[model samples]
Target: MIGSVANMLAHVKNCSKARKVLIYIPYSKFKFNLLLAFERYGFVKRVSLLRYSTNRSEILIELAYNGYYNMIQDIVQVSKPGQRIYWKKKQLRVKHQIGTYFLSTSNGIKTNLDSTCVGGEVICNLV
Candidate 1:
């Protein structure tokens, strides 16, 4: 399982098509580690970290793609927080059944997001 996960991470790091990445971490420590890693590798351009819930402890990361497609396949291995999210791509139709806010770029481009939750609406913007 570890090998397979590593292989997937490698693939993501090698992908040359992705332009943006969004990561959500629920813990401050883990979020800090991820931020350090990003800085160490210089993988993304702009990164936004948002605090979700206090009791639950969650974070949301928004990464802007500059021109580095070589870091897409890198897989982050960590246990999901009480409230966590993962978004992979930036081009797809998004639908939300519950009350949710949709965040997009000024030009309005569809962002790619791979989310795993018990129940919630998915939001994205490709710009």
Candidate 2:
């Protein structure tokens, strides 16, 4: 089994740094939702289902860029397989003024600012 979220984020960050126009990653529900969250933040220009198969599927991600600068500065994976991080509702305040956080809450995959009343595992943060 693979850590899909971490893998997806790493791929995105690497592609962005390389100035790649598109990236293909193994598809999964959580990764798709996380990509949607990135789209909401305008880090990804587009996210679409590229290939479908019973064995292995893929997601096509278009990296967002502004001229010579990449839209995504960095992606920090907070929760790893070995060290999972969780925060209570009261602890879910906006710790950073710049970046936004994506969390897996009971309400589904939502940003820290969105589902504050409920706490969840820290997925990743975009900076």
Q: Which candidate is the best by TM-score?
A: 2
lDDT of 2 by residue, 6-90 (tens): 7778888988998999899888887888888788878899999865567778889999889899999999988888988998877
Q: What is the lDDT of residue 100 in candidate 2?
A: 77
TM-scores of the candidates in the order shown: 0.33, 0.87
Cα displacement (angstroms), candidate 2, residue 35, comes to: 0.5
* Candidate models: Cα lDDT each: 0.36, 0.82
Cα displacement (angstroms), candidate 1, residue 74, comes to 3.3
TM-score of 2: 0.87
Predicted candidate 1 versus true structure: per-residue lDDT over 1-127, tens digit per residue: 3234234334334442454365544445433443444444444444455555555554444443555444333344331324334333332224552222222223231222323222222221111
Runs off by more than 4 Å, candidate 2: 94-98, 115-117
Q: How many residue pairs clash in each candidate?
A: 18, 0
For model 2, which pairs clash?
none
